[model samples]
Target: MQIVFYARVSTDEQTAAHQAKQAKAAGFEIDVVVADEGVSGVSTALADRPQGRRLFDMLRRDDVLVVRWVDRLGRNYADVTETIREFMRRGVIVKTVINGMVFDGATTDPMLMAVRDALILFMAATAQAQTEATKEAQKAGIEHAKGREDAYLGRKPSYTRKQFDSVVDAFNRGEAVAAIHKATGISRGTIYRIRDNRGQAEAALARWAA
Candidate 1:
C-alpha cells in the first residue's frame, strides 16, 4: 500500500514540490508524486489530463491517493464527487493534505457512510464556489485595470493570491524564509517583504488578484 501524491499545478505560481512538502509535513510518507502542470482543474477533467490519465492507470487496489484538496481532484461539484466515489469503488483510499481527510471504503455503517458522502459533496461544492469567485475577481481586476487612466496597475505583483496565501500559511506554521522560498518558488526578497509588512503585501496581492 504505497502512498502517491498527486499535484495539479494550474498556474505558474503553483508548484508540485510545495504541495509534496505540505503532505510530508502532515506526516504522510509519500512514495511517488504525479504532477500535471499548466492544467486547469476548473476546465479539465482528471482523467482527461495527461498525468491524470496516468494516475488512473497507475493506482491499484489498497493504494493511497493524496491531493492538496478535493479541488485538486476536480474543481466542480459533479466531477469531484464522481472522481472520489470511483476511487472508493476501486479500493483506493483518498486523502487530502489540507485537513488530513481520509475517504476510505472500509466502513459498513450506513449512517457513517452517509456522513462521509455528504462531506464530500459539501467540499466539492465549496471548491466549485471558490473557483467561480476567483474567476469573477480576475474579471473585475481586468476591467478595473482597463478603466484606469494609467495602464499600469502598480507593479503587477510578482505572485498570485494563492502563492501569497501559501507563504502566509508557511509562516504561520513556523517555517523559515528559505523553506518558504523553496516551497513557493518565490524570491527571498519578496518573502522578506511579506514578513515585514504582511498587511501591505496582502493589499498588493488583493489588488492584483482582484
Candidate 2:
C-alpha cells in the first residue's frame, strides 16, 4: 500500500518541509508529498485545491493518507468530515500526525465507529467556526484599511496576477497541474478553469489585473 503525506499552508512563505519531517519522524514511510501553499484553508474547500484533488486521485484502496491535522484537510466541518468519510469508504486509511488520530473503514465495533465519526464531525465544525470568525475579522480590517489606503501602501502583495498567469500558461502547455501548483502556488480552481476553459480564465485574469 502506498503511503502519502499531505500538507497545506495558506501562505507561500511557509514550507511543508516541517510537517513532512514530523510525519517521517512518526515512522510513516511516505512515498509522496502533496502540498498546497498560498491557498487559504478558510476560503478554499479541500476538494477544490490543486494538490488536494491530486491526493484524491492518487490515493488507492488500503493506502495510508497522512495529514498534519483535520484542519489541513479543510476549515469547514461538514466538508472535512465528508472528505474523511469518502476516503474511508474508498478503503483508504486516514491518519493524522497531530494527536495520532486514525480512522479506518475496517472497524467493526459500533461504539468505536460512532466515537470516531463524532470526533471527526466535531473537529470539522470547529474548523468551520474558526474560519468564519477569521473572515469577519478580515472584513473589519479591510473596512478599516479603506479609510487609510496610504497606510496600507508599501505592503507587499501576498501573491500576484502574473504568477497565476504563468501557472495557467504551464497548464495550457500540457504540464501536470499538480507540478504547476507545486511550483506556482496557484489555486486548483484556477488550474481547472485554465484547463477546462482557457478563455474564461483569461477573462477572469483580465479583471484581476484591472
Candidate of highest lDDT: 1
TM-score for candidate 1, residues paired by index: 0.74
lDDT per residue, candidate 2, 27-46, as tens digits? Answer: 87899999998887766877
Clashing pairs in 1: 137-210
lDDT values for all models? 0.81, 0.73
* TM-score attained by model 2: 0.64
For model 2, the run of ten residues with the poorest summed lDDT: 201-210
Question: What's model 2's overall lDDT?
Answer: 0.73
Number of clashing pairs per prediction, in order: 1, 2
Q: Per-prediction TM-score, please?
A: 0.74, 0.64
**Clash count, candidate 1:** 1
Error of 2 at 184 (Å): 23
